[model samples]
Target: MSKNIDVLIIGAGAAGLICAITAAKRGRKTLIIDHANKAGKKILMSGGGRCNFTNYFIEYERYLSLNKHFFKSALARYTQWDFIALVEKHGIPYHEKTLGQLFCNNKSKDILNMLLNECKSLGVEILLNTKVNKIRKNEIEKGFNTKTAIGDIKCQSLVIATGALSIPSMGATGFGYEVARQFNLKVTETKAGLVPFIMPKKWLHHFGDLAGTSVNSQVSCNKHQFKESILITHKGLSGPAILQASSYWSTGDYIEIDLLPEKNAENWLKQMKIDKGDTLLSNILSLVLTKKFASKIVSLWFHNKPMKQLSEEDIQYIAEKLKCWKVWPEKTEGYKTAEVTVGGVDTHAISSKTMEVKSVPGLFFIGEVLDVTGHLGGFNFQWAWASGFVCGEVA
Candidate 1:
């Protein structure tokens, strides 16, 4: 005989787990399952294991989507304040790290435990290491018939919270996109977001030895910019600023980096020439940047000329190069190191209020499976929570 459930949520990640708890609280017979050995793998590994649960300043503007306003409804309904309340209620100690990002004071496991406890208290059963092979729409039962390893299960509402194609080593797959196609939903172009950039060999050859060096810089591309510390990796650049700018970069685009974000590098260089400080250009730059990096810049660009030898026009050109140094990324490091996928099931095919398929009844999609992708920080988790909350209420 087939098992009957009111709600069947696929993938026991952040979105699925929260949805299951919400449905069970509504007196719905809910069962959440995942192919992995444990639930909330991403959550446990997020924020360097501290888990940035949500941002203090949650706004729809911080998110990117085919339809920008598609995320506003659900986010407005289940705001970050709502999630923070739940954390406080559960006695999970958390603190804001930076940029309004809230991370657990202890570890990410605390957040996972809290979600699991909520599910347990609500009587929601979570099945681990369970792979779902097939799903068939059931017009007769007005629901879905899903084929799992154990047996066939019938559910009134089916939710696809399977996430997207990032972190493949963690078992990330395009299964969610497959499901959307099975239902004939339009899926937008998918790409890696919030990822590092691998510069060309020529560029790396100039600064490859500077690997492990971190400098606070402003990276910009396509009218978008981020000011943060960028780390010089062996292959290219990797850091919060680079990751943020990578989201807006396309294949053939060039990114600009400001070596000095706080002050005007060009004006400082001009002052050095006017004052006739007998200091080498590199040595003068060393006051702001590292001595080695300053030496490298001088060697590559101007050949270590002294302030007395360089004219005001020469210094101006050098300053312009430092302020607007252009870089063409060979390519993104891809989904392996990416924090999130850029696009998925097109938001136009989804109802923003309920996260349900507009043409298909009793079927819903939420979290990273959808086209909405947030900027770095706690915005992504907030999206998962908001979308999952609204969908659970209806599903």
Candidate 2:
């Protein structure tokens, strides 16, 4: 059995759903296919089920792409406000979380339902639990023939929005990259982003005791810094600050953490020595960090010394260490626990405006499948909406 579609979208994800709705609204016969039983699995689980649909403050700087300016065109064309308006049209109640992140007041399912409803209203067809067995592009006809478990699908415009390899349990796969490769498109090296860092055995041994402890800190790596709460885990470190820094972190890279971002450690130490010389170093540190974490640090660094026992030189050294607490991550938690994928289909090979392959006219790639990755906030979702919207307009 064969069916012809004006636009065939692989992967009924955030990007694919938006693309289908946008194109179908333009009177195109759009069909979205996914291997999963349901669409928008990621959306259903994002932001602890509330779904950080988009960020209030979105800019090109917030995204990481081989071509840094590639996202500007699409993002500007379909701004966050546009999606916000769509949410309002659906009458979904949402609130802004910290750092301009927006989440639904009820559940993530509301966002998914809204997108599905939009697609339904536009007469978009979605095929769930349909796995694509093969895809071939016809040179003469200038179209694509995709064989799936259900049947053969032919389309004038083919879009690969299969997403990236993140959260495999939720059905994330590298099918998008495979499709890009089949079309001779360049795919950059891919890695996990917004993931937790796994500390080396030695470092883990020292800090592992502080598992479940969280502190407000400024964590920096590769010139990128995030000031948020860092959580100490049994495996290594996690939380907003660590997760943000993990995007910029490479293996063997040292991340510096300002344990007390509010205070100049050296100055504060000097003042403390003058005023409360009898106090133990751990006790003073406890004011800023958790008691267990403070005690562990003092035990390892200062040999459990009292403030009065330390000389000026020792005090300065201690203060400097506190200001620049460095930890070398052995590796990231990988795609299994990553919030997104860092690298993907090379943007240089695709048109930034339409997300269409420059060489393959009717083929397009968008969302996490592309090299564009956003920061820890809702920027990723914004990229999905923007790129999908742009591609739908043209493809």
Candidate 3:
């Protein structure tokens, strides 16, 4: 006999777990399942294993969506404070690392365990390593029927919490988007978000040796800008600034970087010329940037000569390049290394209030699977908590 469920949620990640817990607490028979052997793999691996759970600042402005205002209602309803309270209630020791990002003081497991504990306490059934082979509308029951690896089940409400394509090792998949298509819900074009930029071979040939060096600067692309440390990698540039700009970048786009964000480069260079005209330009740059990086910058962008040798025009040119250095990245590192997917199920087809499909009565999509994506530093996790919480109340 087919099992009957009031709610059946796919992908027992952050959203699925919370949604199941809420539904079960509401006296709804809930079952949450995932194809992965373990639930909350992403949560366990986030923030270098400590898990940046949420941010102090969570506004709709931090996110990117086709429907910019769609995320406002849910986020306001289940604010970051609510999630913070949940964390504190579980006695998970955490600290603010930087920019109001809250990370577990111990390990990411603390966060996962908290969510799992909530599920257990609410009597929500969880199944790991279970796959859904197919799903179809159940007209007789006025619900949906799902064929799983173990057995068939019917549910009045179905939630697609399967996250978007990001860390494949974490079991991220396009299954959520496929399900949206199956339901005839419009899905937006998706891309890698908060990802690293891959430099062209010709550019890497000279700068690859400075792979571990980092520069604090402001990176801008497509009118979006972020001030963060930019790390030089063997493959290309990968750092908070580059990753933030990657979300707004596209193929063949040029990224403008302010290498010396704090100093007035022109005035600094001009003063240095009068003060120490005998020093080499590379040597002068070493006062601010790493000696090796300064040398590389001089070699790549300007002629490395004594300060006295550089004319006024040369100083102006060098200053302009220092503050407004431009380079075209070949492309992003793609989904495998990306922190989040840029888009998924279009929010226009989803109800911002309930996270339910506008046309499909019992279908819902939440978390990263939706087109909504947040900036780096824990906003994505907040989105998961908020969207999941709101969807849970109804689904």
Best by lDDT: 2
lDDT digits (tens) for residues 1-395 of candidate 3 = 46889999998988888888778889899999899999999999999999999999886778999998999999999888999999999999999998888999999999999999999988888998999999998877688999998899899999999999998988998999899999888888889999998899998998889999999999999999898899999999989999999988889889999999998999999999999999999999999889999999999889998999999999999999999989889889899899999978999999999999998889999999999999999999999988998999998
User: Candidate 2's C-alpha lDDT?
Assistant: 0.92
Better of 1 and 2 by lDDT: 2
lDDT of each: 0.91, 0.92, 0.92
Each candidate structure's TM-score, on Cα atoms with residue i matched to residue i, is 0.97, 0.97, 0.97
Task: Give Cα distance to truth, residue 371, candidate 3, Å.
Answer: 0.3
Which pairs of residues collide in candidate 1? none
Number of backbone clashes in candidate 3 = 0
Screening candidate 3 with a backbone cut-off below 3 angstroms (N, C-alpha, C), the clashing residue pairs are: none
lDDT of 2 by residue, 124-201 (tens): 999999999999997888899999999999999999999999999988988989888988888999999999988889
What TM-score would you give candidate 1 relative to the actual structure?
Answer: 0.97
Superposed by TM-score, candidate 3 places the C-alpha of residue 101 at a distance from the truth, in angstroms, of 1.2
How many angstroms is residue 130 displaced in model 1 relative to the true structure, after the best TM-score fit? Answer: 0.7
lDDT tens digits, residues 1-395, model 1? 46899999998999998888878888999999889999999999999999999999997778999898999999999999999999999999999999999999999999999999999999999989988999999988699999998789999999999999999888688999999999999899999999999989998999999998888899999999899988889989999999999888889999999998998877877787778568888888888888888888889888687787887778778878888889999999999999999999999989999999999999999999999999999999999999999999989
